[model samples]
Target: MNILVTGGNGQLGSELKHIAFQYPQLNCMFTDVEELDITNQDDIISYVEEHNVGLIINCAAYTAVDKAESDIERARIINATAVKNLIKACELSSAKLIHISTDYVFNGEAFCPLKESDQVIPLGVYGLTKLEGEQYVVSSNEEGIIIRTSWLYSSFGNNFVKTMMRLGVERESLGVIFDQVGTPTYAADLAGAIMSIINSNEKLDKKGKVYHYSNEGVASWYDFALAIFELSGIKCIVNPIEASEYPTPAKRPYYSVLNKKKIKNDFNISIPYWRDSLRSCLYEIEKSN
Candidate 1:
């Protein structure tokens, strides 16, 4: 099978690139904005036709949460409009679409872990645009898979893990938000899950299905920062602070923990604990540094 991965320079895409060698039966083409403009339906159709691409894993997204508040047009273009184009291209080219989404679709009022059947009430521009993107895929009646994840980090890119690691060395102490909570998803693990789904053939492919995936455990930003320092052996002091202490343009969900029962049952794959995955990623970073 031939697979095309969009946003190949991003964290999850990079991790997928690293593990591509594991799946010898599959041929993968990884493309960033330089190689392909997904917003251009003609380009995507031509590329898919030329390459005989069977599947598309769209990792491309407008991820600057706070910036989306001011740059709504650009966010909608990438998150919503581009997705619509991709789904159209998939329809024309007979290719399956695997669109990556976020946990921000929820309003964070739920006391329990969020399920796919839960109602969506996005609070900010980023979430709203992402929800729009998901809606396009769902409404298309296409064989598309949407995996909504939370708090993603990886050694391959700039993320909260890398930020905390850098600040741990540069500063004596720092304040982190204790009120907001979610599980940290390592891109490598998510990549592995995607690969497992791909290799499973018809078993894992559900028509217009949305699934939730992340590491097993949950943590606040403060707990995540402390874990980063502890695992990396950094002597940085992390002080817990409320969300109100530091305001941002984007209003984050207080609790975005996802329910992984469907994905786990359908795919039958194991997910590591958040801290354990963080430790593995930190080791990878250490090796690279």
Candidate 2:
């Protein structure tokens, strides 16, 4: 099967490229924005047609949470409008589109884990726009799978894990928000899960559906930092603070743990816990250095 991947330079996209070789039957085409602009319907249509793409894994997104407040239009263009174009392209090619979404869709009010069917009440522009993208996929008649993940990190690109690791080496003490709680999804794990679904072809019908996935277990930003320090053997003091103590342009959800039961049952894949994935990622980072 021929698979097309967007945002090929991003964390998830880069990791997908690394593992694509493992699946010999899968023909993968990885493209960044420079090669194929997702915002342009014509570009997407041409690429899909030329490649005879059977599946589209959309990893492109406007991920600046704080900056999104000042630049809502740019965010909408990338997050919502671009996705709409992708959906249209998928419709034309009769390809299955797996779009990556985020946990920020929720307002962070719920104390328990978020299920796929839960009501959405995004608190910021970034979250709202991402949710809009998800809605567009669901409304389209094309075959699609919307996966909502949280606190994603990888060996590539900018993410919380890398940020903490950098700060641990430079600073004597780092302050992290202890109030916010969620699972830290390793991009490799998510990529693996997507590949599993594509290979199985059981859970998703031609019609579109939504699902939630993340690494097992939960942690605050503070706890996550502590784990990084412990795993990397970085001698830095991690100071735990409340969300209000560290203000940002966007309001983050205090709790956004996604329930993986549906995806687990449907795909029949095992997920590593957050700490275990962290260890694996840190180990990879160490080897690279």
The C-alpha RMSD of each candidate to the native structure, in angstroms, is: 1.0, 1.1
- For candidate 2, give the lDDT: 0.92
Query: What are the runs in model 2 whose C-alpha is more than 4 Å off?
Result: 206-208
Tens-place lDDT per residue, model 2, 127-224, is 99999999998988887789999999999888998898888899999999999999999999999999899888774643238899999999999999
lDDT of 1 by residue, 162-281 (tens): 999889999999999999988999999999999999887753246337999999988999999999999999999999999999999999999999999888888888999999999999
What TM-scores do the predictions have?
0.98, 0.98
Report backbone clashes per prediction. 0, 0
Q: What is candidate 2's TM-score against the reference?
A: 0.98
